[model samples]
Target: MTFKELKHFLGEINVKVDDLYAEKLFNECDTSHSKTLEGSEIEEFYKRLTYRNEIEVIYSKYASSKGKMSVEDLGNFLRMEQREDVGLNEAVALIQKYELDEAAKEKKLMSRDGFLMYLQSSDGLVLNPTHTLVYQDMSQPLNHYFISSSHNTYLMEDQLKGPSSTEAYVRALTKGCRCVELDCWDGPNGDPVIYHGYTLTSKILFKDVIRTVKEYAFKNSEYPVVLSLETHCSMDQQKVMAHHMKTILGSMLLTAPLGGKMPTHFPSPEQLKGKILVKGKKLQSREHSMTSPESLQGEEEESVSEEDEAADLPEEKGMPKKSKLKLARELSDLVVFCKSVHFPGFETARETQAFYEMSSFGESKAFKLAQESANRFVIHNTRQLSRTYPRGTRTDSSNYNPVDLWNAGCQIVALNFQTSDKSMDLNQGKFQQNGFSGYILKPRFMRDGQTQFNPTSIMQGEWLTPKKLHVMIISGQQLPKVNKNKNNSIVDPLVRIEISGVPRDVCSAETEHIEDNGFNPSWNKNFQFDICVPELALVRFVVEDHDTASRNDFVAQYTLPFMSLQNGYRHVPLLTKEGNPIASSSIFVHIMVVDQ
Candidate 1:
């Protein structure tokens, strides 16, 4: 019988089907009939049956006792009928006549799978089998794969070859990392240079760095390398450095944001033809706008009058101008050349903080500002926010978890491994548990002492080892497994059995058979034997042959219903001649219950 049919039948009779009682019912029903019924047929019979009087009695009893009947309690009632010599057909008829009001009660105890199906059909919360809410984000399109740092096999320091630092650029390109971040500063000659430090000693000509990256990409099929040129130089020098990057790298280099605009001055489509991506303005909140009362007066006036007077104001005065000098057309044209933008120093925690700080305004103005940006917001140091955010804090009141951050609006949250933040750890755990996809640690974070500029950390530290990071990621999912065992109540959940004793030649063949089938078998007495059992409702075991092959066999199946009061685990004695007790299998059965 279908599980639903069987459940329906039990429901009509004012009886419940629980793990243990369900197993008992299955055994009894199967034994009573010539052939086992399909799970569906069993369920259908109960669903069609009507129970009027029995339901009233059940309801009256529940009312008197101020208690509701559970699936197990219903099973117990059926068990009592069996003990009293009640025929299945007659009992079903009686139940159909009396018990009809318990359908809602049964729903509360559905298995996880069943419950999930109900949720999907009833509430429209489409969830995967793994229990993750499914939705889509328009701004961040899903990419098939991402390039990451090969930290397990390579080190960044090893790439710093010669005064050119070209080797560092080469190493990243050769590894197929489409994106590379380079630290830049002003040199003694007032030129922008590639370096990871704020001082000139670490600087290398910006042109050389771009040339090396371009050469590597050309040799490797024009692979896109998003070179993040972080500048610790004067604004004018930074703009000059951006120009040099465009000259040498052409379409192969990415320019950092310069005064709310992209670096490369692409006046025409020809300038953008083969160049690398250029990042435009950083995603910021409306709060970041530095509008003086003087600038606001004209905008406020424009709302009152729709005339050309509002348009008469100089565009420069109407809009906030770039703080440093760079051709206005160059800034505007570069925007058209850019492929995607990056938000440096934008933190999710900071955004969340901003949300609460603006909560008094009812809606978040910062969030609105981010939404207005056409590009994605790459949040840096998200791990810090995930780790340190108070779990039950008032400002954090939302069903949306950390994995929902990207869907909520932020594109990617970048994590730096060298920085120690509990929020990042927690966020990573949530990501794995929910199966959300996003970026991971790349070369920039893997380089030694790269954490200094990582806003979360004030000091530079040695690069985090790959092994430690992998372990952290793996362990994030380990707690669920551990909890399963720690919460198990069933005692004597496993019993080990050894099979042996056959003619030498026969035994050898049996051993070979086991080995060929990947079953593990071992010797015990003189009679060669294997384990077998009838399928039970409440328990499931992961069995393997103890002989050479380690092939799995059905050692035992419980005949009892599941009792939450009892541990989830259960044990049964091994059988020998004539259903007699013998040794049992040592395998443990991990039961997963689903109700629908």
Candidate 2:
């Protein structure tokens, strides 16, 4: 493709690039300093953008007219791609172990459906066979689970200058993110728009976002979705957002309680299936009905204290008093499930009579609460939902660790999904085990009436284990081709097992690197790690290409919850840079949970 065409293509995918950056990219691709990329250079460019290896797998899968591959054919494909000759016996055994097809065991033929299922499972990436509706107790209240949530779900990239698109909402929802944030402001044509305020992030229409949510909210899982609205629009513009939501979401929107009487307890996920709940500030009168007169007085006193604090600030001293923004009653009524509120201290919050009331706190404030008055915060989260978001300084759209907050029974631990960092890894690890339904039932000890569990107390005398994790790095199949110089193009692949969590920093072990192989390479080497806190531990398997002169490049990786990890022989699916599963690419392993 021409340089101009390449720029246009990038634009179509919402990748904004200026002329100078485009020229630099073109020069890099054209390694010979040629005007355009050609041959190997062109192929390299396409491989970085798209799944070239995955497409090759699909090609090999359908190479035969029968839409199936024999054991020999499968082995040949693996060897050809990974540049390692895999034996037919081992290939047939894998097919049998994965239960690729009941007929495959007898006929030795792997069907297309079986191949697709293997890819979707991420080569045993999922802990269980099925990955939906995994709650042990469906009757448990909604607040009794650690919910998968996203912060600033509209921005596709960084906090500042990122392109805001409805695609972000779809991506988050499809990944079982139960809670999504929408920062709404007045836009052209009087319609509400979603974007990060006082930033260079592009705008996307609010109505378009609602439509995307309506289509994808319940597509992956039939659980309720909490739409956390950060409204900064005028009352008139807020009504437009309300109208757009009601019109677009239709019957899926939950605008009132299930019954006429107020909920004595929060509803369960089972009860709110296929529902979209708006979460924002409700009208004062509606809030007044829930709180007693004494509680209301206490809230007023707290508000006065906040105003006094704000008055002391130099910025506030010279600023004019802005008029109070009023929330439209129609929009306010939609906040039936999670009504967002400013968190008062734990003392005042305990006595409040509000039902289904929710509050959000910055990461720093949440940490302070968990540290100074951990028990009070614990008691508050038991009955009511709480959301924790990243602090304002995370300009790169980074995320905080949600595990510590989950230990405190905070239901909505929102993280920046745009940045696929350690925080997102933890979010994926926690949710991937429980069917990816966006809700995992909190531990019994963390429930509303239960006071036995304290996150601060890690030295529980009752439960102790010094078990060790023994893993056999068996082999890799159909590994992706390395995009590098032909002289050193063949990667020396190795498997690294990382045990991440508590007592100290992350502990890891690696296998000996196999030379001149990206495919069916074997180590058969044993590595072990002593488990200090099994309940809080996570295991991640990473396949990296060993380099002599430069940094080792990542090939594929999978992280899983240690408690739910399957024992014995298993296949781990590899993921691409885009976080999508690489078809027909996996690492074989043998795992054993043993005593220290």
Candidate number achieving the greatest lDDT relative to the actual structure? 2
Q: Clashing residue pairs, candidate 2? A: 82-519
Each model's total of backbone clashes: 65, 1
lDDT of 1 by residue, 485-511 (tens): 332211211122221111111111111
**Candidate 2: global Cα-lDDT?**
0.72
Give the TM-score of each candidate. Answer: 0.27, 0.73
**Candidate number with greatest TM-score:** 2
lDDT of each: 0.29, 0.72
In model 2, which runs have C-alpha deviations exceeding 4 angstroms? 1-126, 130-135, 288-324, 353-355, 370-376, 461-467, 482-487, 501-506, 532-535, 548-550
RMSD (Å) of each candidate, 1 decimal: 24.4, 10.9
Candidate 1, residue 233: lDDT: 53
